[model samples]
Target: MKAIANALIVTIASASSALAASGAAADEGGFLAPLFLAFGAAIIAFQAIPAVMLLGSMVKGFFSKKAEAGANAR
Candidate 1:
């Protein structure tokens, strides 16, 4: 229990002493960040349409009967 209390105190002290950089020291992703993010989102959206259609057809096929088998055998 004493070791646990010491560890907790150390954690609290380290957390309080940590600070973020001020002003010019901050990191930036530059002007192209939003453009890259938008492009990625658009790519995902375009890919999703075909994926949804394919999944829908697959699910429909699973629940559907193979009635065409008998007709084709004729």
Candidate 2:
């Protein structure tokens, strides 16, 4: 899907940039590594949060009142 592809692209780019920044900063200041690390983590979390919500909604639907009502109506 397009969303998966976009996530992959973003993850790859973020990882690459983080690595680059980390290496550059290691030679001078150590601050950028943590910043880039946080950036990469945030990117991954953003990508995963939607999927987690969607899966939670799907699981909730299986136990929901609406599902019971629909089953009774059938």
lDDT of each: 0.86, 0.85
Question: Per-residue alpha-carbon lDDT of model 2 for 1-74, expressed as tens digits?
Answer: 99999999999998997777655434744799789989999999999999999999999988875645666684
Model 2 regions more than 4 Å off: 1-29, 64-74
Query: Model 1: runs farther than 4 Å from truth?
Result: 1-25, 68-70
State residue 45's C-alpha deviation in candidate 1, in Å: 1.0
TM-score of 1: 0.56
Report the error of model 1 at residue 72, Å.
2.3
Give the clashing pairs for model 2.
none
TM-score of each: 0.56, 0.38
Provide the lowest-lDDT 10-residue window in model 1.
17-26
